[model samples]
Target: MPSEEHTGKSQPPVRSQPFPLEFPGVHYFDEQEIEAVKRVLRARSPFRYYGVDLQGEAEAFEREFAAFVGAKHAVAVGSGTGALSVALAALGVGPGQEVIVPAYLWVSVVAAVVNQGAIPVLADIDDTFGLNPASVQARISSHTTGIILVHMSGAPADAPALAELARQHGLWLLEDCAQCAGGSIHGRKVGTFGDMGIFSFQMNKNMTAGEGGCVVTSDDRLAQRAEACHDLGYARDRNGRLIFDSPELCLWGKGTRLDELRAAILRVQLRKLPVVTAAMRRSKYRIRQALEAFPQVALRRIQDPDGDTGCFLITTYPDAETARRVNLALRAEGIVTYPQGISNVLMTDWGLHLYYNIPSLVHRTSIDRAGFPWNLTENRGLGGNYAKGACPAADSLFERSIVLAIPSCLTRSDEDDIIRAFEKVLREHLSS
Candidate 1:
């Protein structure tokens, strides 16, 4: 049991642990990262120069990351959302088209699809918090151009199944690996399972570069398109040098470029990813083992436990009411729970309030008040209403689920304490 000395006034009156287990900060920088940034600063020339043939930090990081993920080509971009938008454009997703995405993901996923002048159709998720293949199949229409399969919270979705479905329908498959860096399924990494994959190096992600992203693909044409689309559609040669004489430009291209400073920091962070993911996996396993005795507490469905990056531990309760009670009990014991959203946007206990459910996309037919996309009579019929029962499975799961952010740097003692806290709370609930 935790001692009373650990209790704080803000926390409820319960046995307090010495360390209040809070979610780990996103920016976990070390001396190496600081030194890497300094080195880039010292170079003074951070901009990627064309026709130089010399590998800059961004290009070098791209090559290293490509090799690490077993991809033939890697294109670094400004951010994960930018990576997705560029990849979608590369895959030819444009107006009057649709892209299927899981309902449980961050708003950025939907935003990326909408930004392409396409309709984002929200699909239901399975117990793994990933897009259900059957749901995806059902959601696909004649206008559906692609599917964005997200590996939610470092857990690999049924990529093999999703891949087969995409192939059968002849739809482009894009892996949203924003949260699942260093994660794999079977023996293959999550990003490689799709035609093209995007990764985020955001501060809160498993890997960090403050704000950066990458698109990896083995397809030559797709790689070229992504490269061109990321840099305002500037024509580049085989060596990624700009062709100033080219009259061609990507219509959907944006100036989303990854700088050398972030690229340098990412290089150092990339090398340490395996070690960090391993530690997280160990901590999650320890916590899962401790909670195994409680039948009412179900661990999140993981397709490959060994392959999981273990960035988050999600448990489901028997019912939504039961989950609510446990949430209060845990908080009373000074245990932290996952926030509904960033800042102060509180999500409903049933999880009905979601990014897709916002009136702009759901109730209103047009993306903008001017009704540009929806006003096109051809597109009006394509847009679907995202009502309360839009994704029942995801809503139920969110209501019953308690997500815990697993830190990459946890000691054995810290893991043990976490296990103890969970066990204490579950036992109390079960007895009651």
Candidate 2:
């Protein structure tokens, strides 16, 4: 706690109880979800493709999710990481190629690229906390094959500009919508903006089934490739048998199939997603409006405010130290910034999500001692600097920005408690 002498103002009133920090989708579970899971279990058909009494929950979820996101097709995967690898393999991002990714992203993003035998080139993030188009352009080379545009937090990235860039360079655009599953830009859902897009229903997402995700695409051939890559390295006939006629078009499977039990829960969660996002958005907007009087703190730039999932609120201070002080004050006030992964909330903690802190990527460690991916025969001369100052803009941004998650369920008092803390803390630390 900062002493009154250090702060130049008396400490504000603190909450008597700890804030209710919770997982979003979990809050909305009820009898509907319980009955859905029971139906799957009772049928004894836990698998989606085949069983004694196949419930078709997985197939139904995929079809509904694809339609909701405005995509022609969707393939359910075991997890978000599974979806990422499937999308990369579908795009042929392997051996000697590079994929441009934002420095502020999930660690699994790089893992997906490396698993495909491709390299991940870190790019800076702008005020949007999304990929910087200029940085991506500067890094593109003959070895570059695609751009993985991540909708960081709850908001959509600048997909139109990135899509145009991809078209001009003839590179595939893969949208990482794990953070922004129901997000959109001007009413066009996020997952449909790229040639291939993926969403996570992990426990922490806007909607969840504990561990599940899906890949969506409008391209017929790309959809086929993703299906084959996620299943058995071959296409299945209508009667559920593998067909070997299209050997040239076949992709090696990673066996990332989604099961019937998870699919049933996800189906219920999907129906409740709009409501989940709406509640969070309402609370977040109200909080931001109340905090606007403090000019020292700026809100994150959302391309479409209404389209955001509204789970995370990013507030930026002028410098690193001030950001640190304000965050400490908030915690002292009994406010939980982000509970799922505390490291991601303030961007203060390292060795978690930041690009430079990734030991394997920064040190260029590969599966083999000879540096298989980095030192592969086709990867000669392809390199990147993953040192501390590689992405200068993003490095500073992380230090200055503090993210807070808006719970799926919040009462009026809950909202007021947040605003009260911001009002008290910002006035003391941010007042000129």
Candidate 3:
């Protein structure tokens, strides 16, 4: 646990929850979002860039989102995973090169590498539940072209260190901000820390439009490349028409354009992002503050407590068995850890989030029947292990830790109940 003055507060009374916690932005849905979508529908300009009504909501959203994250540009895409693919493509990360990604990241990260016809080398995460710079350094080789730094669980990774690491080795750094849209580090927003950053607006994210995403970057050339990659493999000319003059700019694209309906909805959600993150942060810190009395367990390490977006609270017990028993006790008291129907708190149940759990990755599934990426002459000896024990530290930590989703809609009473339940459970087990 990080050093701080222990609160030493006594346990409060536990009460039945008013409701279970849920994703942040969904709780604040109001007429603004509905009206935004209504405006788009009324305009009949569902397409972005060149709509019939030309509402320009998608372009406006990209501008606002770029300014919001302190980046020069933003490209609205079809999904978070598509943004990853676009970023990898923009950086020219394919065939014969490997991209180092955190083992504790979404499957899309690895899938993007494979889809780009590149190898993905897994790097262990540190206590921050993010990429360990030292581990990344050790994995770097001649074939390494870039590193994908994922900021997980609404907390910023050690970006400054990782950015410097990438610089020292001359590798492109792409920050995955899908889980932490509005998070920052030392007051600098997360997405601007690396060469480029990606965000998601899926149903379970901090903000939601059902499903949407964007990529942010400060580089002009890369931004153009990303725009082309998200479109039809053709860079737009100055007059805003597709141009196929240069072979460098005429690469194959994914056709991942952002529709105006989702863009209109996201414009409203983007404005409310700070509010969503702030509420969860307050609730999270208060719970962590109360739990500081328990010396027997530790909270997951954070790069900056002030910068944490605070969607989840992770506590590590001495062992996996103790963590499991404590969680069962909490649930018996009507205090759930994760939201209903979601059981990704433990790594064993964390489906595709962990590399080893992904069947395609573990089995080295081929994209084409020809088995190009893995069987290619350039990639023959480059396959890194993707078995269960490949990332021992991350696996062990997840097994011994309990994650509690902190909803932005939590009331003071809700926060008190959660703290009391943690107090009750820990007192019974750790007071020994």
Whole-model alpha-carbon lDDT for candidate 1:
0.77
Global lDDT of model 2:
0.87
Give the per-residue lDDT of model 3 (tens digit) for 1-432. 101122123432354443454678888889999999999889888888665687888889999999999999999998999999999999998789989999889998999999988998989999999999999999999999999999988899899999999999999999999999899988899999899999999987898898999999999989989999999988876445888788879888988989999999999999999999999899999999998889888888887887899888888898888888777666555565334535225545667878888899999999788996888888877858998788888888878887777888888988887887788779887746
Model 1 lDDT, residue 409, Cα: 69
**lDDT per residue, candidate 2, 1-432, as tens digits?**
324454455554455455555578999999999999999999999988888899899999999999999999999999999999999988888998989998888888999998888888988989999998999999899999999999988899899999999999999999999989889989999988789999998988999989999999999998999999999888888666788899755669989999999999999999999999999899989998997888878888888889988888889999999999888777766676333435225675634468887888889889887887898998887759987799999899889988887888888898898899888888778859
Model 1 worst lDDT run, 10 consecutive residues: 341-350
Which residue pairs in candidate 2 have backbone atoms (N, alpha carbon, C) closer than 3 angstroms, thus clashing?
Answer: none
Among all candidates shown, the one with the greatest TM-score: 2
Candidate 2 residue 362 C-alpha distance from true site, Å: 1.0
User: In model 3, where do residues sit more than 4 Å from their true spots?
Assistant: 1-18, 237-240, 337-340
**Clashing residue pairs, backbone N/CA/C < 3 A, model 3:** none
C-alpha lDDT of residue 87 in model 3: 91
Note the clash tally of each candidate: 0, 0, 0
lDDT of 2 at 196: 94
- Model 1 regions more than 4 Å off: 1-28, 50-55, 237-241, 244-250, 337-359, 364-367
